[model samples]
Target: MKKFPEHFLWGAATSAPQSEGHGSLNGKSPSTWDKWYEINPEKFQKNQGPEHTSNMYENYIEDAKRMNDIHMNSFRTSIAWTRLLPDGKTINPEAVTFYRNYFHELHSNGVKPIINLFHFDMPWWLMEKGGWESRESVDAFAFYAETCFELFGDLVEYWTTFNEPMVHVECGYLYGYHYPAIHDLKKAVQVAFHTIMAHTMAVKAFKAGKYSGKIGIILNVSPCYPKSHSTEDLRAAELADLLNTKSFLDPAVLGIFPQKLIECLADNQLLPKVEVQDLHLIQMNPVDFIGMNYYQPRRVQAPATVNHPAVSPADFYEHYDWPDKKINPYRGWEIYPEALYDVAMMIKDQYNNIPWFVSENGMGVADEERFMDQTGMIQDDYRIEFMIEHLQQLHKGIEAGSNCFGYHTWTFVDCWSWLNGYNNRYGFYRLDLENDQRTLKKSGIWFKELIDRNGLL
Candidate 1:
């Protein structure tokens, strides 16, 4: 095979809450997603809703078999904290048993399991207690991490402490894009600090437990592109890069936060309140691998002049501008596939040859029309093309000497997106919302063939 290395892993990624529907009866506590929909169902595209949707909770055996048929060497999925520890204190063995059996099913087919600890799903009980903002939530997260290692570390070889920490900080705290939408940069900084400390603690706890597995932090890394040659634009891009990527990348992998980030926080007088030895703890415990969920690159430009001055984040900095870019007609996220090459090379040159994997990468389209041929499969050509371009970039990364371990596309099956609801379809296997049934898209069938051969013919 000219594509993948002999030891390289090929997998598909999914999170528990997004795929394992049946939350209503599955003993799953209300996650942030649950509460968000409850608060503003109208915000979701087309008034589409979120509930027990995918039914993976009940149909994992079929899913596993399908993955096996597709020759998936590995599978990436998250453990919903709420699904396991609904009250944030009590452990749910039923949920534990369910996952154990699912991993057992995957292993039976020789599929490597990469389990993430959190993927934007926090128990509403914890959110009620102020979620990550409160120190108690940090302790709660540590306890959950420890419990997970004790329970399922043996079957799983990969443990990702989080899936995109910056999204939680920017969306949930500063921009109010995600759940518990608040508009305070101070709170954002505090939450970001606690999350770093929590990841550090999780790594320490994982190693202390003597689990023979690789642990890492997942980041949605977007390489910033300056709009023009203007100095202001370049500085804006730098700030965006530090805030969006390095804030988590540096501390998690390099054992220290970036100096530029430290200065930026201090300049705003919004430096987070930290415990006595938080910095020491973060600098001491480093991760084993870096998980990347790349969708699109962000282009930054100088801030537009604000007409009104108020006590708000708008007073802080500026918007991003991409002077030249390719566009993804389906979603507005720029279709700059070359950035994947740039991302991989940037990591190799900057991050000390750390082992990394593409945790998630896929295109989200508005409405993928159903395709049923004589052989019974849905056709999704765009998704396959998306994978081909990105994977070629990944292959180029490997050629450039990046220690890339795997390339897992964004998802296996179409599931509920956070705010977009069911508007965007990003899956190899198409999930029919009308019937709650699963059908292998033509891309899914084609992927099976490609993986069996290790690449497209």
Candidate 2:
């Protein structure tokens, strides 16, 4: 039998914007998500916006009790910037009180809280001032992060500056899939740069404040695989890794950007305007650890023809669909359990074996009601098998000396997904949208057994 290390953190992750309803109540200002939903309700599935989420704001005490029942030792969630600092400067007392109560409840329930400062839910006020595109917004974010540390540092031990920061730049700036939808490559590069600046600044603030906690960033490090052994295909995969994986991973871990990525941006004249001091600050403040969120591997091949002026990541490499690839039919994402092992080894070999954890990993299925048994419990055996396969690979990585300390699924309960809304559910607890109630699925029960045993045979 394989055994996990002692004191491994077991839990799930959710963000405030996705799980907390009441967008504009309790002195909270609107975030970009709220404003976007108001303007384009049809963009979200079933027209379900961010208004009627899982209602965690009102049910956090019960939710924490549920987490205790599942034997979860830790949980990750983000603080809504708009909720804490409505206008980006003034503090909201009601928001602070609610968060303190929530964190205290979790602690009382034997669960540790891993607090993330930002999770793509940019404040609408900051967006009005050019969001992350402007240096002003970056400084404001650092201030907000410092405030969070000051307020909750006594209760929390782990802090993350941002959650998957690159996704916002890519989806919102380059791909038009998220809020502030625009297809501007120049703005995307600028947003990515300022985001790293904001993160390092926050890390600097944390150290200056002398907080007693480990600060880090969460990255979705999907390994890039070449479609074939040809030189062109290998080069394509390399570029994909530079853009998607190392773009943020390098700076957070090594306190610098990859040289090749810098050259690529400079050659294409897509480099953002920079101040010398910002680069110095980035070089000085490296994170203490990182969180790795992996779902699928990126399979890439050389593009048929590179654009005369490269405008997007796709200009260099195009996605390659692997033959006979296993997939999650409901979410349309390829299922590759081996990728977990690859991600683990990559962090060990290339990142100096930095301390990290599986921050988000799970399968999202649509309409889980069909799988409910007569007793009203969901017999989600498929989710159990998925977890087993991935955990086996993670165990192999740990045996090979990856410095991973924990595993966290995508979510604790069924909550709002960005544009997909509640179309796909990725949770151990089934949430009734009609009424704010949660019930554990079979996978949740199996996970408790895994936690009790500390491993699998």
Worst 10 residues of 2 by lDDT: 305-314
User: Please, what are the lDDT tens digits per residue for candidate 2 over residues 271-333?
Assistant: 889997977788899988899998888999999978756988888799999998999999888
Residue 363: error of model 2 in Å? 0.4
Candidate 2: pairs in clash: none
What does candidate 1's lDDT look like per residue over 188-218, in tens digits? 8888888988888999899888898889989
Counted clashes in each candidate structure: 4, 0
Top-TM-score candidate index: 2
Which runs in model 2 stand beyond 4 Å of their true positions?
A: none
Quote the lDDT for 77 in model 2.
94
The parts of candidate 1 lying over 4 Å away from their true place are: 306-317, 320-324, 370-376
